[model samples]
Target: MDKKKPKKVFVEGAIPPEKIAQSVANHQSKTNIGAHSIFLGQVRADEIDGKTVYAIEYTAYKDMAEQVFHEIRESAFLKFDITCAHIYHSLGKVNKGELCLFVFTSSARRKIAIKATNYFVEEIKAKVPIFGKEIFEDETHQWKVNK
Candidate 1:
């Protein structure tokens, strides 16, 4: 039942604060949307092996990742009464405290929007082929595994 075409979900570097605002502003004309839920995934400065992570360099099998993203979006649309959904992920280096992911869902009801947003975030984290290389402050890096 996935009718939508595959979308390029990856953005370069970190997702800008202005992009989020613009997304919200862009949806104002959709009068049927009563509630919107948004999730922002920020990079954390984690300490491991006595080194602190300063950034994450992200990479993915682009073609496969885009298809998976399309499937997820279509699944969300079929499962929820959401009017709109948007997902963006960062590629390349995203520094600590910067946003790496943004998920937004809108529906006629508050609960539906929130549930759809949650579903998108969960599915993306679990199913997407995106990989992150955790870059330490000292310039060393390690491949990060999602938990």
Candidate 2:
């Protein structure tokens, strides 16, 4: 199952816009990749119990989470004819509208790339033991579950 030495997929904070752009730029050299798909997950300001969410504090059991990510990575490549894939998720508090997750997939065809990216995202959401605490505007908080 050692396809690629389980890439480091976690970023220290909210993923910066520049980093996303750089990811695209870095792939320009891959001439064989005809298409690339990207998925970005952002914190949303949702009103819950008369309070507005301001940010999300993300946490995870690092070793287990990474192992889950690794399994997902291998599964994705096995299921799709993807040329490359990348996943990044925030490790700390990320404000509303800021990026918390980034998933990229590339292939010779657009459909495969898009499909692989979506599959990776679903696997991550359903399998990863990552947790998020939604912080409301008034400092109240609640555990977040992906919906």
Candidate 3:
């Protein structure tokens, strides 16, 4: 019989800071890493031509999103001598200035952790099938992908 292996990285719904911290701790428990670096992306309310962004609604093609995320995890592991990595992004409505995405990478050295964090975030943004709708104070909205 083929044995199924448990997933190392978790991907789920609107991730809170507490949840992310918990996952980081869980990953760290089994890792002998000396450094952990995290990068969190937050939604910001910005005024565009007198219109103020009040909130954001996030949506994703879940199947594709998961596939993309999985690739990112594999790539990170192959590229960096890292112990573990975790990524979470919000879905549905998120208020202005709220946390949107969280990425944590731990490695035996700070240099690897830093490099991995940057590469992970960039790859996720560029490759993920996540979309965002920016809702303005006036109730108008627009869909945008991370540039």
Greater-TM-score candidate between 2 and 3: 2
TM-score (all chains, Cα) for each model: 0.97, 0.96, 0.86
| lDDT for 18 (candidate 3) | 83
Superposition TM-score, candidate 1 onto the true structure? 0.97
* Predicted candidate 1 versus true structure: per-residue lDDT over 92-124, tens digit per residue: 999999999999899999999999999999999
lDDT of 3 at 102: 86
* Candidate 3 error regions (>4 Å): 1-14
lDDT agreement with native, every candidate: 0.95, 0.93, 0.79
lDDT of 2 by residue, 1-147 (tens): 555666688898799999999999999999999999999999999998899999999999988898899999888888999999899999989999999999999999999999999999999999998999999999989999788
Q: How far is candidate 2 from the true structure (C-alpha RMSD, Å)?
A: 1.0
Estimate, for each residue in 6-113, the C-alpha lDDT of model 3 and write its tens digit. Answer: 243333444577877687768756657899999988878888778888788888887778778887888788899998787777888888877888888889999999
Which residue runs of candidate 1 sit more than 4 Å off their true CA positions?
Answer: none
